[model samples]
Target: MAHPYLAYYCLNISTIPENSSYQSSLSSLLSSISLYATSEFQFNKLQKFLNISDPLYGLQLCHGDVTTEVCRECVATVAKSLAVVCSRKLVALIWYDECMIRYSNESFFSTKNVLPGFALSNIQNITELHRFDQLVNTMMIDLESQASEVPAGSKKFKTKEANLSELKMIYSLVQCTPDLSTTDCNTCLQEAIGTLPVCCNGKQGANVLMPSCYVRYEVYPFYNIIDTAPSPATGLPPLPPRELEGMMNFFFLIFF
Candidate 1:
C-alpha cells in the first residue's frame, strides 16, 4: 500500500554559451529557479503560482494534478542535480513526477522529438498477462481520445480508470512545455504513445518521455493534492500537474 498522494514537478535547463561566459549562463539558468516554487496545497489556502522572468531561455510546466510538497521536492531535486549532469550541453531533460522543466538554445515547443529516449519496467509482472495487456490497450485508446480533446493551453493532464477488477486502476499523466502551442503538445504526446508497445511491452508499469512531453501508466495512485477554494471550488493560481497508477507512476521532468 503506497501513498496515493505523492506527486512532484521539476524543470531542467541546459545552454551552450558561444563565448563561454559561465557567469551569464549561470544567471540565465538561475532565473527560472524562483519561478518554479509555489504554495499550491495549503489545505484551506489557495494555490499561489510564482511567475518570474529569466535572463536566458527557459519554460515551466506543472501537470495540474499534484500537491505543493511534491512539486517543491521535484523542482528542488532538479535544481540541485541539473548542473552536474548537463555540464554545458546547451540542452537537457530532467524527469521527475508528472511534470518537467526543460530549456535549450533551440526551442522545442510545438515539436516532436521521436528520438526514442528510453523504455523500461519494474521487476514484477502481473499474474494475468493476457488480460492486463488487453485492458491496457483499451485504456490507452480512451486516454488518447480524451487527452486529444482537452483544450490546448497547457497540455498538462492526468487520467485514470479502474481497468481490471475495479480495485486495480489504470492511471496516466501527459504534458508538454508551456512554450508550445496546444497542437504541438498533442503531437508530441501522440509520438510518445506510438512507442508504448516497444518501450514498456507487457510490464506492469512504464513511462515514455521526451523533453517536451511524456506519458505514463502504473497500477497505483501517485498524485498529490491540488489547492482549490472550498465553497465554490473556485480556481486558484494554476499549479503543475502529475498522476500515476498501479505500480507505475507519473514522471516529473526538468528540461534545458
Candidate 2:
C-alpha cells in the first residue's frame, strides 16, 4: 500500500484528444501492461503497443528486493493510477516505493535518462557529517560497480551494509533497469550517486530516483535483506530478515 513518491507528465507534448484513435490505443496498451505485469510475476517488464497513428512504449519495474506478491500489487496499483492521474497525456511516469511505471509516445528503451529525476531526504541529519559522507560514498561506489556488472538478462541490482558506529549502521540499495547495458547502468548509477551531496548532504537517509536507475541509503534497514542474496565475489553471507513485511502490512492498514 505504498503511495506514489512522484509523478511526471510530458507537459510540453500535446495531450491526446478525447475519443481519438490514439486515446483508444493508449487504453489498450495500459490494459495489456497491467495484465502482463501482474500475471507474470516479473520484476521488470517492457511493452510496446504498435499503432500506425501513435505507438506507446511502457515499462514497469519493481525493486529487486521486493517479493513477488509485493511486486504484483505495486505494479497493479501504479498501472491503475497512471491511467487516471495522467489521463490523455502522451507521456508520463509514476514512482511508488516498491515500483515505477512509465509510458511515452516515443520509445526510451535501453537509454540512460537522468533528467526529470528527484531526490528525497530525511529531516534528521547525521551528527558525524564528514565521516558519514565518506562512508556513503564508498559504499555507494562499491554497490554501483556490483550492480552494473551483472550479466545480460540478470537484474542490475545490489545492496550493501556498512558500520557507521557500534550502535548505528548504514544500509544501501542501488538498481538499474534490466534492459540497460552494463556501461549504461554504471553511468546512470554514477550520475545518481553524484547528486547526493547537492540534495541530501548529511541527512540520515535519502534516495535519488531517475527513470533509468535509483539509489537509496538509510540509517535503519528499509529494504528486504532476506530477498537479497550475497554476492559471490564478496563472499558475504545474507543478512538476517527484518520485520519489513509486518511494517508494510501495518502501513497498508493505516493508509489503505
Candidate 3:
C-alpha cells in the first residue's frame, strides 16, 4: 500500500534561477536543524539570495513532527527534484511525501496570497447539508482558537482534539509560517476554511491548504510528535484521550 499522506494535493510558488542561492542555502540549513520541521519562509537579507539575477530568496519551515533524517531528505529532494519537475516555471509547487516544498521570488513573508486551491474528497459526505455546515464550521472555530494559541516558539502549528461529544471526537491541526503576520496568516487559512463547504461539502476527511497556511481534520491524529516533549499547561491541552495518533497521513503542500 501507499505510504500515509501520499494521497494529497498541493499549491505553491517558486522562483528558481533568481533564487538559486536560496535553494543552495536551504539545502545547507536543513542539513543543520534537527528532526521534522514544517515551514516555508524566505531568507534574511544577510544571507545570499538563491538566484543572483532575480535577487529574490526563499525560506521554509518543516513540520515539527518529522525526524531530522526525513526533513533533510525531503529538503534535498526539493533542491534536486523540483528542478526537474517544475522545469521553467518561476513559481511552482510539488507535494512530495509528508513534506511540501516551495520556493518563490515573491515576498511570501507576511503577505497572504491564495488561489483556487483544490481538495480531494474522501468518498464520504453527510446527506444533511445543514448539519454538515454546522459540523465543519464548529470544528473550524475550535481549530482557529488552538492555532492562535499555539505554544512553541517558532512553530505556530498545532494538532488538537475536540470532544464533539462523549461518543465522538475530531482530530485537527492548523498551521502558518511563524513569519506570517497574524492577519495574513489568519486570512489565508480562513480562505482554506472557507473552501470546506464548496469542495469538501460532504467528505468525511479533507485537507484545506493555501499558499501560506493549511488546516486538516480527520478521525485520526496525523502528526509524528518528534519527541516525548511534554506540553506545558499553558494553552494547548493534552492530546484528548491522552493518545498520540501514531502514524500520520500528513498532507504536506510543496511549492517550488
Candidate 4:
C-alpha cells in the first residue's frame, strides 16, 4: 500500500558523486532519522562525516499534532522511498503530510528558504470570492505573528478560527521551525502567504508547505482546537490535529 503522504510531493534537488563512501554516509543519515527524529522533540538536525571532504547535514520534522509513533512511521517510509527514488542524489528534500525530511552537503539550519516547496488547494472556490480572499489574507497574517515568538520556541505555532458569518468560519494555522529567528520566520511566512492569490485565491482552503515553515487555512474546522497559552520557556510548538494525513488529493502548485 502507498504511504499516506507519498502522493503529495517529492523533491530530489542535487545528486551526490558516485562513490562507496557517500553510499555509506547516506545509510548512516537515514538510520539516524529513523532512530532520533521521533523523540519528544519533533525536530532533529544531523551532521555526520564519513572520512570524506564533505559531511551530510539533515533535518527531519513532523507536524506538531502527530504522536511520536506516527512520526517514526513517516520517517521510515520516507527513508525507504529516498533510497529508491533519490538514490544518486547528494541533496534531497521530501515532504509528506505529517513530516518532512531534508539533507544536504551544506548547512541550511536557521536560514530562510522558500523554494523547494509546494502549495495545495481545494478545487471548490469560495462563493463570496473577493471577500473571502480578503478574510484569508488577514487571518493568515495574524496567525503568523502569533506563531513565531522566541524563548523556548513554544510560540512558533498557532491555530485560530475566525467567524465569517453565522454559518461560516475560517480555521487556519501557521508554523516555523524553532531553529529560525523571529525575523526569518516572519519573512518566510510573508512570502508563503503572498502566494495565496496566485495559488489558492478563491479556493475553499489552501496549504503551503516549505522546509522551514508551513501555512494552512480552511473553511471548515480541519484542525483540533487546542490551548494557545505561551510557554514560560522556549520549546517545541504544540501539536495540532493530523487532518492533512487524509487529504491526499488536492491541486498542487510546485516551486523549484
Candidate 5:
C-alpha cells in the first residue's frame, strides 16, 4: 500500500521586500502555525489573522481522511519548507498530499480567489471522452453541493463514487476550509469543477487544487471512505524551545 502521508506541490507567490518588521511579523505567524499544528486537528482546518504591525494572515487545511497525527506531520513539513523556500515571499502556499498551508500579508479568509491554482491529469485519454465529460460534470456538481453541507462544526468535505462501467468507477473528493460559509465554499468548488473542460478533458483522471478549495477524481480509490468523522483538535507535540531556532537555521542554510 502507498504511504498515506505525502506532499503534492508548493506555490511561492510574491516576495516581501527586505523589511525587518515584516520579517518579524512573518516569524511570529510561522510560530503560531507550528503551534496550531501541534495542538489542533479536530476541525481539520484553521484560519487565523495576526494583528501585528504587519498583520499576517494564514490558513491550513488537511484532507479529512487523514488522522490528526498525519495532519500535524504535514503541517510541520510545510512550515519548515515555507520558512526556507518562501523566506522572502509575502505570499506562500504549499500543498501536501495530506494537507495545505498558506500565509500572506493580505487577508484571504472566506475570500474566493481562484487564479494561480494548478491542474494535473493522467496522460492516458479515455475512449468515451464525450460521455465521460458529461458524467464528470454531473457528478462534480452533486459533490459540490454535498460537500458544502457538512454538519455544523464539521469539516467541509465529501467523497463519492460513480460507476463508469461494471468494473470501472470514478472516485471523487471535494473540500474547502471549514471557515468558509456554505455559499463561498460552493462557489469556490464550482469554479474549480467548471474548469474541467479546459484543464483535464479526455484524461482518465485529473485534479485541480486551489488555496481555498480543491476537487479530485481518479479511476482508482484514493480516499479513505470508511472514516467519515472529523478528528478532534489538540495541542502540539513537546518541542524544546530551540526547535524554532533550528527551523530558522534550516531556512537560512538553504537560501543564504
Candidate 6:
C-alpha cells in the first residue's frame, strides 16, 4: 500500500472554518482531481474551484512509471488524507510513494517550491565510498539534465542505470512536475541533488523529495524499467563514453 512520506501544512496560516464556503470549494476541488485520475490523457491534473469568494488551487502528480490503476489509487488516497492530515490548513502538501497532492488558497502553478522537502536513506552504507559517490553524482547530474530539458507539456522524468562493479549496480531516477519550465525544472533538480551529501552521503541508497522535483538512487531497482521510456522527451543523447569511462561498466554482469 502507498503511504505518505511527508505531510506539510502551513501552520501560520488560518485554518478553514467548518462548513464554510472555503471548505465546500476545497471538497469540490479535491473531488474533481481524484475523478480525473481515470482519464487517459495524462497522469497529472491542475485544477481550481472558483465558485466561492476564496478559490482553491490544486494539483496531483503520479510517478511517470506507475500504472493507471496505481495512479488512481494514489490520487484518491492523498485527496482524502490531506484534509484530515493537514487539519484544514489554507496551504498543504503531501507526498506518497506513487503520487503527490498539493493545494493552496492562492495559485502556485508554474512556480518552483523547494521548501518543506524531505530526504530518506538506507541504513546501510557503501563499502566503497568514494567510487560509489562519484558514480552516483555523475549519473544524477546526467539524469537531471535530461529530465529538465523536456518541452513544457511533456513529462520531465528520466531514469538511468550503471554497473558499479561486477557484483553491484546503481539505479537512479529524477523527475519534475510537467508544468514547470525548463530552467525552473533544472534549478529544482539541482537543489534536490545538493541535499544528498548533507542527508545521505555514502549511504547505499537515498531519496530527495521536494515540492517541485525529486531525485533518487539505489543499489536495487525501485522503479519499473519497462513502464518508463529509456530517454527524455527531447531525445537528448546519452553521456559520452569518455565521460563514463573507468567509472561505469556498460555491460551488465549476470550472476546465476
Model 5's alpha-carbon lDDT is 0.67
Every model: Cα RMSD to truth: 8.8, 6.2, 7.2, 5.1, 9.7, 9.6
State which candidate, 4 or 6, has the greater TM-score. Answer: 6
Candidate 3 lDDT (Cα, whole model)?
0.51
Question: What is the lDDT of every predicted structure here?
Answer: 0.51, 0.75, 0.51, 0.73, 0.67, 0.76
Question: What is the C-alpha lDDT profile of model 1 across 101-186, one tens digit per residue?
Answer: 45455445445554425443443567777888787777765666666565544334546544566456555555554445556666
TM-score of each: 0.67, 0.84, 0.64, 0.83, 0.76, 0.84
Candidate 1 TM-score, true structure as reference: 0.67
Model 6 bad stretches (over 4 Å): 1-7, 10-12, 39-41, 50-52, 229-256
Worst 10 residues of 3 by lDDT: 38-47
* Candidate whose lDDT is highest: 6
Per-residue C-alpha lDDT of model 6 across residues 59-115, encoded as one tens digit per residue: 888888778888898899888888778866888888776688888888878888887
Residue 236 error for model 6, in Å? Answer: 28
- Give the per-residue Cα lDDT of candidate 5 at 248: 17
For residues 128-206, what per-residue lDDT tens digits would candidate 3 score against the true structure?
5575457667877766765655442356576655544454455566777666665666676787777766666655556
**Candidate 1 CA-lDDT value:** 0.51
Looking at candidate 2, what is the lDDT of residue 121?
A: 72
Error of 5 at 55 (Å): 1.4
